[model samples]
Target chain A: MGLEHRAKWRINIYAWLLLLPSLIFLVLFTFYPVLQTVILSFYQADLGSPEPFFNGGDNYRIMLEDDVFWKVLTNNLWFALGTVPTSIALGLAMALFANKALRGKGFVRTAYFYPTVVPMIAVANIWLFIYTPEYGALSHVMEWFGHGGMNWLGDRTNVMFAMIFMVIWKEAGYFMIFYLAGLQNISKELYESASMDGAKPWTVFRRVTFPLLMPTTMFVLIIAFTNSFKLVDHLVIMTKGGPDNASNLLLYYIYETAFSFWDQGMASALTVVMVVILLLVAAIQFFGLDKKIHYN
Target chain B: MRTVVKGLFSVLMSMALITGCSSGNAPATGSQAGAGAGSEAAAGSGAGKASGEKTELTFFYPVAVGGPLTKIVDGMAEEFNKANPDIAVKPVYTGSYQDTTTKIQAAVQGKTPPDVAVMLSTELYTMLDMDAILPLDDFIAKDGGSEYVNDFYPGFMANSQVDGKTYSIPFQRSTIVLYYNKEAFKEVGLDPEKPPQNWDELVEYATKLKKDGRWGVEIPTSGFPYWMFQSFALQNGKNLMTEDGKKVFFDTPENVEALQLWVDLAKKHQVMPEGVIEWATVPSDFLEGKTAMMYHTTGNLTNVKNNAKFDFGVAFLPAKKTFGSPTGGGNFYMFKGIDEKKQEAAWKFIRFMTEPERAAQWSIDTGYVATRKSAYETESMKEYVKTFPVAAVARDQLAYGHAELSTHNNGKVTKALNDSLQAVITGQAEPAAALKKAQEEADKILAPFNK
Candidate 1:
């Protein structure tokens, strides 16, 4: 018994040794900066006040009053609502289509995934040209339908929609890869049994394919949710949150506050708010929704 | 007992790793300076700085205009190094004016600012607020007092100083000008030699020039709408801000009328695009014949000259009441924290880079207005301008040029105005309402400085 306990302890030590590198990195990079940001949120530091001073909740108060902040937050929500579910659905649909026996399957997969391979900044630049008013690719296409002269990125009403569509085009393929993996993981017997029972393709997908892919869907949901908030590189290249902050996102707002405006305290506060939002979302997905997900 | 000892060892090892990671991260702070030193070493190789005794300086500049200006800047640095063996200058090309200011702010915060930088002239108040830049009055006095200071065009110098203290030296400076495609003008039955001279003529000319698949004129309203709007405001009646940089007059009737005319150019007259036109794309549009005439900086003169397959004419921006433009572009500024030796070396480098002959060459090469009045008198400048008379349009228009919109809390203030201008241009809001909202926003932002 004594020897067994010692062996278990030795195993524990080895496990800790294996975890040391990542643990140290997490503590150093993530936790320390988060703690610093939390502390900074309570201060008043800006270009005007380079030397920081404690000003309790003033930054938060200003953020609450800032119309731009509210506009960016609303834009982010609309962006997420516009991109997430549609991309996931499109991803699943593409995965389902590709899973079947089809000619040029490799070509189809490559074409779909090509956008994901390109960098976001490069994608934004390409799309920026495609959205130019008269001579842009989209305008030319619209001209075929007698609907020419649409400013994709310049108009407030269209900028958000345009950005959402581009993000979906870039992201759906990435999510498709996971769904394809999940689709393959299900045994062939389940489909055969469903066919033997005379279940239609739609019913089989409803009852068999989707329920078993819950684990992958859950993981993808978390990733997509966080990404909706985190993906801001396109804003830098395309809009700079222009047309009166119509397409600005939370992270970009934080970046502008910290760097461009030189309002570090306000940036820290914005970051904290963003972190809380992401944490709440992740918690909901992990704890509340995970219980209902079916795992094989 | 053995198990406990193993557990303690594991804990100690993890602690060691945590401390190691932190120590490893310490160099990240110095990485910017290290990168600068590394690039200087690479650039200094041609100068043969084997002595290791030279005072090295990192100079940051932005390329706001088109062309291979970076190569020219690097060549200037190399020439400076060869002329002065004791100093090594590394020119780091920061992005546009916005990106350059952001980088400068980051460097200053990190306590490792470049020795010299060419930031936007409108960044004067922002730099002053941060106390990051040094006053150049001392250096100017040592050089030639008011004589050296007065040599730079007063129009460009308008935003370079405040409270009787000169803070920046004008280098790459520009004013707004009208760029018209001569072929398009002639095709539209207008004289190629005569561009629009006033508001009424502008609308008439633009209407005549407008056709299918072509805009008559495009004043870009994307990147620096506030600067372009300032030109309109100045032409109408008043400058955007006070001379002291303490207050702004954005909601005046003249400014509102200016914005109204801009909106009307698109909505009522249907001569220009209805939505925001990008700053970078406007020049390309002109080159592509998508627009017959464009309001753009004279900095694009070299670019248009090189790329235009058809003849083009450069003239003053059409006046509302009088011909006016806001002087725009970067000014050379020295940082405050450097040692006296480095300061003098930086000052020497600035003077070298801004010498009359070099200024004339720069203007000829890059199409930035030669900042010094004496530069135009130089033989090279005279010869170049004689052949290319359009290159001197911006210089002649400097007489009517005023300072760009710069005030306390400049970024936020300018952003408020930019948003309002964009709103008005996009037809999302009326000119009067937007300007009033912008004025209120600016007042709130500048309230702290007012006290």
Candidate 2:
């Protein structure tokens, strides 16, 4: 009995030893920064003050009145709303069409998945040349179409929409793969079973496919929404929140505040707010996910 | 079970191994001064050998836009290393002026501050305020180059010194100069030699020079307006800030008058094109013969020289009430915690770079101006910098230079100026209202430091 007890203790000790490296990484890379950020958010830090002094949330208060902060936040929300649903719906449609017996089906699948591999910053560079007010491919096309040139990224009103359009173009392909996987996982017998009961194609899809794909849809939505919040890399290079802060997004604004202004305190506060937003969004997604997703 | 045990054992071994490696790689201690055992160990090659051990030092420097400077520094370092064989200077190019400052701050706080750093001369004060930089007076005296150091123009040296302590030595110096298209001058039939002297003549000639696809004068209002403001204030007999650096004096009559000319050039006269904020490509524009003239740093002269398809000449920026041209340059600061030996090495590099002959060669190579008075007489410096009555006027105007008065809060000030400039150009606000609003926004930011 003592030997068995000693063996149990040995197993427990081994488990802890195995996890020790990972635990260290979590503390050093993740928790340490989260702790640092929390401490930083309360102070006013710059090149002058290497270590910040306690400013007692003045950074947070200043953020409230900051018009650029408000602009960036609204721009982020606009980006998320604009890109997510459009990409998801497009992904689902493409997945459904590809799932059916269609000609050149394999080629279509590869073609639909191509944009996923091209990086956002690379795509932005291509898009930048394309949208140039003077020497752009788009401008040339517009001239061919008997319309004058347009400033796609240069126009304040059009910049967000332009960025959204590019994002949707890039993300739809990536999201479709998940839908395809989900579609493949759905029970085929159920579809035949519905058909035998004289159910219409629309009716069968509405009743069967919709219910089954809920899990995948939720996963895609969660990933896509979070991605939109985090991914504003194109803006950093393409626009730099310029044409008068028109296309600015939250994460880019955080970077600008920290690096450009040397205001680490404000940047950290912005980061905290972003984290809270992401947490709430993720929580909602997770809660909803449990309602529909089932294990085999 | 054997496989699982093997995996578990491997994981344990790896954890121990990695931790040992990482701990060993942490920021080295006392290696800078060669005092302690740890320091000697870090000096790496050999304590047993006859001479001294090789020391490793990091230089935190800004990467230029798309970063050619890093490559240049790296190339120079490789050459320097080959020549010396004992000393190694590792240059890390960390983004722009702003990003470099942030990085230096982080390094300092982390207690692993860089041995040497290239800093924007304007923000040298921030480091000085924290006593992050070492005073070079002792270094100069130790070198017995007291007279040699004094050979630099007193006016040029003022920007590097604060309260009798010289914290930085100018790495590259440039003052704003007027660049004109010779072809445009000829086309307008205005004698390129006799450029505009004051606001009234500037407007008149700019109007005459204006034609289709050619702006008379161009100013990049967004990125840094202080240069433009400095030119204006120097002419108008005023400074942007108080000497003590406590308060901003924008929205003053001198500034208003200066900004009014900017507005008149853009909005009222329509000589400068509309909706053009950054003169990012003004050099290109002038090179391509799109704009007749631009006011920019002497640093841009090389690019103009390299790319200009037509003859161009450098002139002093047109003055108002007096000749004020702000110094546009950067400095090298020894970061705090850089120990005595490395500090000595850093000064060696600075002195080598700033020696009048080196100063002339580098200035000619990079189109930087010779800050040292002795370098002015060098043949290379004289020949490379194309002569003009305007350059002389610009040199005379150097007496009025106030260093760029931007703290870390410079971004806020930049924004205010950008916003006001945009308003005036876009006809969103008239010059007075726009400047007033700018002053208000600027004051709001300045109030914190004021308190």
Candidate 3:
């Protein structure tokens, strides 16, 4: 018994030793900062104030009443609603197309995945020129179609839609790779059996392929939802949440509050709200949807 | 049970290791580039101690205008270091004015601020509130007292002082001016030699100049709408903020009329675009001949001069009640908490950078209006002005210039006004209602400072 216990003890030490490196980083960068942000949310700290003071729930109360906060939050939801399902469906369709035995399959896959390789900031700058009024590439395209002089970014009504379209173009290709991987994971025998039973391609896709891809879809949904809240680099380069905050999103608002306004307490509170939202979304996906997912 | 206990012990051991590593790593990467520069300067000073004592100073500056301004700044620093071998100045480009301010805030919080920086003049109140910058009165007194301070243009100096104590010295300063395509003016049947001189003429010229493929005029309303709006207010017979920086006059009747005229340029006259005109793109639009006239900083003179394929002219913005613009740009400020030796070196660096000949060269090199009045008297400035007569238009407009809108809590307050202007310009809100809302917001923001 003593020898057995010693062996187990050695294994435990080895396990902890291996984890220590990443564990320290995770604790320092992630856990500690999260805790600090939570604590800061309860304080009143602004650049004007000499020192930070406890303000209880004042930050939260102010956030509730803050018009910009609500506008950005609503914008984020609309952005997610617009981008998530469409990108996922588009991703799946592209994956199916690429999966078929077609000529130049590699070229098609590379072309589909090209945008995902570019950094977001560079992408935003490229799109900035593309969307610029009067002389932009998009304006020239619009002129060809008799819709010249459409202000893609300057008009408040169209700014959000423009941002949503750009985000979808950048993200759909990324989600396609995951769906492609999931498609390859499904047993070939299942498809063969279905085809042998005289199943049409559309019917086979509906009844066989999509159900097997549920796990990837759920994972992609969570990623897309979180990403909609996380991405704000484009805002810095593009519209800057302009035209009366039409294209503003949650993370960008928090950044402006913290860095630009120097309202640490308010920014922390906003961050807490964002974290809670992301957590709730992830929980619903992992718990509520996991039970219904058909795991192969 | 024994395995669990051993695991807990190992966890504590790993925690200790983590803390040890982090503490060891903190100084190396704590404050990003600032910390790295600090250690390098420290090493230089240590090495210099064995020879003659040397003070290494880090100077942070932002490039708001387009050009190879960073190269100019670096070259100046190298010249300074060569001229005064005992002091070495390292110039760090910290991006735009906003990014530089943010970086300084972070550095100050980390207790590793650069020895000197050139931040926006409007940041005076914000820096004072943070207690991060030093008042330059002592340096000025030691140099030449009023003689030194008075050499700077009074209009540009308006934002550099508070309660008779100077905090910053003007460097790259500018005023809003009308940049017009002379070729377009000729094509529209207006005399190329004559630009609009009043609001009525402005509308008439713009209406005549508007074509299907081009706008008549574009005043950028996206990035710094409040700055552009301040010109309108000043032209309409009011400045946006008081001298003390405690009160704002955003909702006055004059201001309302100014905003209404701005809206009418697009809505009623159909001369300008209807929505927000991006600040960075307006100059490009003018260069492309898509806009006949543009209201932009005179600092862009060099850019427009280099890029324009057609003849262009610079003039004072068309007056409403009077010709006016708010002086804009960065000023040299020494950070607080540095040693006396470093402070003296930094003061020398500032003086060297702003000498009349250097200022003239800078103006000629990059189109910023020379801050020192005597800079215009330099032979180089005279020859350049004779060759390119429009280069002096911004300097001539100083008599009508005022301070940009700067107040306590400047960021939020400015944003309030900017949002209101954008809303009105975008036709989402009425001018009266939006300006009134902006005034209330600014009042609330300024209330604490008033106390």
Candidate 4:
């Protein structure tokens, strides 16, 4: 019994030795910065001050009062809602279609996944050319139909939708690969049994395959949710949160505040708010949604 | 669990590494060139002790307009280093004016600021607030004093001074000029040589020039709407900010009328496109025959000359109260915390780069207006102007130029006006209402500085 306990102690030591690198990295890069942000949110700090003057939640108060802050938060929420489910649905649709045996299967698969390999800035540049006012591809198509297309990136009414459409085009293929992996993991026997039971394809997918794919769906949900908050590169290139801040998202706004305006305190407050929202989503996924998801 | 966390950390690190590498390298001249030169200077510092160890100066610059500016800047630095062995100058090409300021500000905070940098002239207040720069009054006194300073155009000087003290020297400077397609003017039956001279003429020419699915003019409202809007406001007999940098006149009736005229160009007159014009692509659109005329920085003259397939004319922006444009572009600034020796070295380099011959060469190479009047008097500049008379318009417009709007908390104040300008141009808000709200915001931001 004593020898076994000693062995267990050795194993614990080994485990901790292996974990040291990541633990130090996580502490330095992630957790410490997060803590610093929370601390900074309470201070009236510019960059490089040895000690930020204490401000007693003034940054938060200012954020609450700023109309643009609220607008950007709402924009981010809408961007998330607008992009998340649509991409996931499209991803699942593509994955299901691509899972089947068909001619020129490899070519189709490559075509579907092509955007995932290109950088977001390059994608935005191409989309910018396509959306250019008169001689753009969309304009050419519109001219053929006896109608002039509205400016895709200039008008407040159309800019967000334009950005969302391009994001979906770029991101759906990335999520599709995950779903494809999930679909491949499903047993062939289950589908065979469903067919033997005379189940229609849709019904079989609904009752059996979907329930089995629940775990992957939840994982993808978490990924898509996190990505919506983090992805603001396209905004930098495409719209720059313009048209009266109509298309501004929270992350991009934070970047502009911190970098352009050089207001570290306000940016930290904004970052704290973002972290809280992310935490709430993560809590829901891990504690509530995970309960309904079955694992093998 | 340990492996998973490790894998995640590795992925994050790699992603950051990739972005960092790409952003620094994709731009033409990377700061790594400066870093590489610093180590070389360090190696020679001990060997060259008989004369004096060289003061290694890192000079960061930003290229706003399209060109091979990075190559020109690097070549200029190489020439300086070769000529003055006591001062080894390393030039870094940051991405844009905005990016350069951000990098400098961050470097100041981190306590590793560059010895000198060329940032936007309007960033004067921000740098003063951060205490990141040395006032140039002493340097001016030490180096030929006010005579040297007086040689620069007062229009460019207006933006470089604060509180009657000089803190920067104008280098690559510009003003907004009207770039019109002579072909389009001829086609519209307007005199190809005589571009619009006033507001009414601009509208009249624009209306006549509008034909077959192309707009007449494009005044960009995206990247620097506030800069473009300043032209309209100045022409309407109003300046956006006071010389004191303490007050703004954003909500004045004249300014409102100016902004209204801008909005009316798209909505009421239908002379320009319906929504915002992009700054970067306006030149491209003009080249593509999508627009007959564009209001843009004179810095784009070289780019336009290269890409334009037809005859083009550069004119002073159409007048209202008077033909006016705010002088714009980067100015050389020395950072604080450097020893006097290093400061002297930086000042010497500035003088070298701004000498008449070099300034003329820089003006001919890049399309910036020569900062010094004497640069234009140089044989090189005179020859270049004789060959391309269109280049002379920006130099002449300096008589009507003012300092670009700069106040304490300049970035925030500029954003307030920028957002309001965008709001008005995009038809989200009426001109008077938007300008009033913008003034209120600017007041709130500037209040602390005033106090």
Candidate 5:
């Protein structure tokens, strides 16, 4: 018994030793920053000051009172709501088409996956010129129709939708790959089984294909949700949160606060709010939505 | 069970390898810096082996716009290094001014600030508060006092001095100017040589120039909206902030009138775009003849001159009460915590870079205003100005230029005004209401500094 106990202890030590590097990284990069953000959120940390002044909950209070902050938060929420489902649905449609026996299917798949390979900054620059008033591609098309062109990026009412449309164009292709994989995994026999049951095509898809793709849909939904919060690179190039904070997002606002304004404390508080919201969302998705997703 | 254990072990090992690969790279670069210092010492000794070693100073500068600026800056640094063998200068082109400030501020916080940086002149109060910069006064006094400092244009100098101490040296300074398409002016039946001199003439000229496909004028309201708006307020006989950089008068009646005029140029006069105009696209718009006239920095003269197909003219911005524009652009600041040797090396580099000949060369090359009055007197500058003639408009406008809008917590304060200005420009809020809201925000941000 004593010899067995000593051997088990040795194995346990070896296992922990193997994990040491990953543990160190997790602590240093992830956990430490999250802890620091929480702590710093409680203080007033001007970059110029020697030490941060402890001002409990003041940063939070300021965030609550900041109209731009609220505007940006709602904008982010709307952005997520606007982009996620549309992209996912488009992804499903693309996957469905691509999975069918069609000519040039290989070329179509490559085309669907092309945007994911391009960098976001390059996309933004291209889209910026493409949205130029009266001379851009959209404007030229509108001119062909004998209608006046709208200021796609400059007008407050249209800017968010414009951004959402671009994001969908960029993202739907990426999400399509996941759905394609999910589709491939669903056995062709299931479709034949549905057909033999005297089901129409719509009924076959609704009862058979949809349930099998729930896991992919859930995964892509989480991705699209997080991306809406994280993707502000296009904002930097296209708008810089202009036209009266119409298209600003939480992450971009935090960047402006921390880097541009050098107000780290308020930025950290904003970060904490973002992190908490993400956590709650992820928790709800993983726990609540996980049960609904069919697992083979 | 054995295969599962083996797979888990392999996965853990790969994870460890990946994390190790990442975290291990940082210290290697740190040690590389150590090695670099050693090599630098050896190279310094290897140069002469008799006189003391050369001092290498790191400079952080930003290029706000995309162009040949990085190459020009690198060429200037190489030239300076050639002229002064004792000082080895390294110029690092950081991104825009905002990025440069963030880099410098981070370096300061990390206790590894650069020897010198070209920051925005409006960063005076921020730099002072950071306690990150050395006062140029001491260096000037040690190098035989105010004569050298006084040679710079006083309008540019207005932003360099605070509390009777100078903290920055002017470089790449600019003032707003009007760029009008001569062909468009002729087509509109206006004299090509004459530009608008006052607000009434501006509106009249714009009205005459307005047609189906083109706007008569465009003032960019996206990037640096506050900077452009300052030109308006100053023309309307109001300054944004006090000389002390404390109090701002955003809600003053004159400022309201100024903003009202800007709004009316779009709504009431119907000669410009209705919503916000983008900064980066405005130059192209001007060059493409989408707009007949534009208000932009003089720094864009070279860009327009290169791309414009038709004849163009540059003139001073039209004034209302008295002709005025705000001095804009970057200034040289030496960081604190560097040794005197590096500091002196930085000063030498600044002197070498800002000599009358070089300053004039920079102006002729980049379209930035020459910092010193003597630069305008230099033979190269005089020749260039005579040849182009429009090149001198910004230089001649110096008499009417004041300091750019700078104050305590300047970024947020300017942002307050920018948001409000944009709000008004976008027709979301009225001029008076927007300015008043901006005033309240600026007051709140400035409260701590005042206390």
Candidate 6:
């Protein structure tokens, strides 16, 4: 018993030795910056001003009541809701479909994933041409399809969905890779056992396959939700958060508030709020997935 | 768990490593031509001798000439080093006007404040108001006050000065003017020399200018509508903001009427393109003659001169109540916390860069309006003088020109207005509702400032 305790102590020491560098790094980069941002959100705009001061919760109060701030928040929520599930579902759908035997399967998979490899900004340019109100290639294709063109990203009513469509297209392929991994990890023995019991494919999938893929789904959903809040490059090029701030997500608003508006205080406040929101989601993922996680 | 945390940290480090290396090499591959243009500016200057001896000054500037622009700006350090033998100037190319602002805040908070920054004129007021910049009244002592002040056109000065103290000097500035395709005007049988004088006339003229396979007019619907709105509101004798500057008063009758006038040119008239997002290469539009009239900066005249396949003429934008246009350029402001020596070095660079002869050369080379009156009197100015007389108009309009409704939070409120303007023009909303919503939104946006 003494030997076991001694051995455990040695292992604990070893483990801490290995973890020290990361702990130090996290303190320096992530945790410290977050602390700094929180501190800054309380201060007025004197990050480098000749006179800097702490203004209590004034910045937070301002952000909370601001109309455009609420609009931007709503836009972000809409963007997240629009982009996240669609991408995950489509990704899973494509992954499941592609995991089957098919002719030229590799080529088809490669073609589907092509948009993911391209830079978001460059792809946004192509989508801009597609979203143009007149003589855009997308509109031209629509015209050829025997339909009149709708201004994809230009009209305020149509724009969030338009951006969501582009986001789904670019991001679904990326998310599919994870789903593909999850699909590949499922044991063939389970399927064989289910088949021997005269289980249908759908029944087998519902009972065994999906539950096995739960961790991956949870991971993918967390990532997709985080990304939906973060990604707004296309909005920068295509809509510029307009025709009336329709596509202005939280991060884009943070950028606009900091750079375009030159309000670093409010921007930092917005950033803290976003970070808190993300942390809540992360917390949910952490606790909710722990029970369902089956390593074996 | 220990290994997992370690792995994540390593991944993050690798990401940082990749980002740093890639950004360092960015100028080599991406935007090299703009970088090359910046290099010409930095080319002649030599870096300071040894690290300890040189007073290091960091600078940020946005340039049309990319690579050469940095080199030219850093060249100031070299020139200053050679002249003073005590200072080093490191000029950072801060991509666009927007990027410079972000970097400035980041760098300052990071405790490595740049000694000098070449800021957009619109940016100067907010920074000055925020106490982000150091005033240079002492630096103006070398030149005579009134004569020196009178040298540049009045509008140029207004863009630089706030309250009573001068905060910035015009570097490369321009006023928005009408760059019309002479060929398009001729095709429409409208007198190229006789431009419209009112909003209705502007609509009529644009309608006439519209032709097959091309647009009639294009307003860069994204960024610059504020300047145009300010111009018209000033012309209409309406203030976009109150004097104390802590309220939303843009919904006033005169401003509504003025904004309606401009919006009518697009929505009701259908004479202009609906959603040309920005004045992305306005001269290119003029060159292609894609639009009959290009309402853009005087800084773009060189581009028009270079690329146009057809003849073009510059004309004053029509006025309603008073003739006016806002000054749009940049200012050279020294940031705080630098040693007196570094500040002096920055001033020296600004002085050399803005010398009448140098300003003239820059104006001739890049089509930016010369900020120095003496430069306008030079032989180089004679040709553009005979051709456009815009320098005079831009100067004359200084009495009427004001900065865009700018405050620390002006960016949000202004964007709300600009976006609503686009919404109205694009038929997303009617003008009355759009303006009403914009006013409501802007009030909510400005509520913090009011408090």
Q: Please give the DockQ score of every candidate, comma-separated.
A: 0.38, 0.19, 0.41, 0.33, 0.32, 0.21
Model 5 agreement with the true structure over A263-284: per-residue lDDT tens digits: 8788889888888998888999
lDDT by residue for model 2 over A1-296, one digit each (tens)? 69999999999999999999999988765565666677778988754465579999898999998888998889889999999999999999999998884799999989999888887778877887676543457767888776534556645666788899989999999999999999999888998899899999899878889778888988899989988877776876577676567777888777776656657678788888887898899998888667776543
- Cα lDDT tens digits, model 5, B31-109, are 2344778756764676666475778899999987557888988898999899889888999999989889977886775
Per-residue CA lDDT of candidate 4, range B301-339, in tens? 998999899999999999998989998998999997665
Which candidate number would show the highest DockQ if scored against the true structure?
A: 3
Q: Once superposed on the true structure, which residue ranges of model 5 sit more than 4 Å away at CA?
A: A1-15, A47-50, B1-51
* Residue lDDT tens for model 2, B1-451: 0121122223324434555555554543324334566665644444466365666678777744321556666776666667666677787878777678866765654456789887887765456545566777778787836686677655456667765667777767677878888778888899977878777888998998988667798876434556676668767876666544445666777777777788778767978855534445566667767678888777777688778898887776776776567776677787666665677777766666677776776666666667676776777666654553333434555566556655436666666766565556555567677777777887876676665
Question: Each model's C-alpha lDDT?
Answer: 0.86, 0.71, 0.87, 0.84, 0.85, 0.70
Interface Cα RMSD for candidate 2?
11.5
Off by over 4 Å in 1: A1-10, B1-52
Writing each residue's lDDT as its tens digit, candidate 6 over A1-296 gives 69999999999999999999999988876776666677768877632344548989999998777777898888888888888989999998888887884887797688778989998889888887666644666666777676433556655667788888999999999988898899889989989889999999889878988888888988999989888877777766666787667777877787776667756567778888888999999998889876887654
* Preferred candidate (TM-score higher): 2 or 4: 4
Compose the digit string of candidate 4's lDDT tens values, residues A1-296: 69999999999999999999999988877886677678878998753343569999899999999999999998988899999999999988988888784887787678889998898888889998888888788889888786564677888878888888888888898888898898888889988999999999899989888888899899999989988888887777777888788888888888788767778788889888888998999999999998898676
The residue ranges of model 4 lying beyond 4 angstroms of the native Cα positions read: A1-7, A47-51, B1-52
For candidate 1, lDDT tens digit of each residue in B1-451?
A: 0121122223224434555555444322212344776645654683475556888999999998778999999999999999999899999999988788877876665556789999999889989989898888777878767988899999999999899998999999988999999999999789999999999999999999999989999998885699898898889988988888878898999988899999889988999998888777789889999999999988889889989999999999999888899998899999876755578899999999999999999999889999999999999999999999998889999999888888877878888998898888778899999999999998888888888
- TM-score of predicted chain B, candidate 5: 0.88
In model 1, what lDDT does residue A39 have?
Answer: 88
Error of 3 at B36 (Å): 31
Docking class of 3: acceptable
**In candidate 5, residue B391 scores what lDDT?**
91
Q: Write the per-residue lDDT of candidate 3 for residues B12-66, one digit (tens) a residue.
A: 3344455555553343222334567676687578677657867899999999877
| Per-residue lDDT value at B76 in model 6 | 50
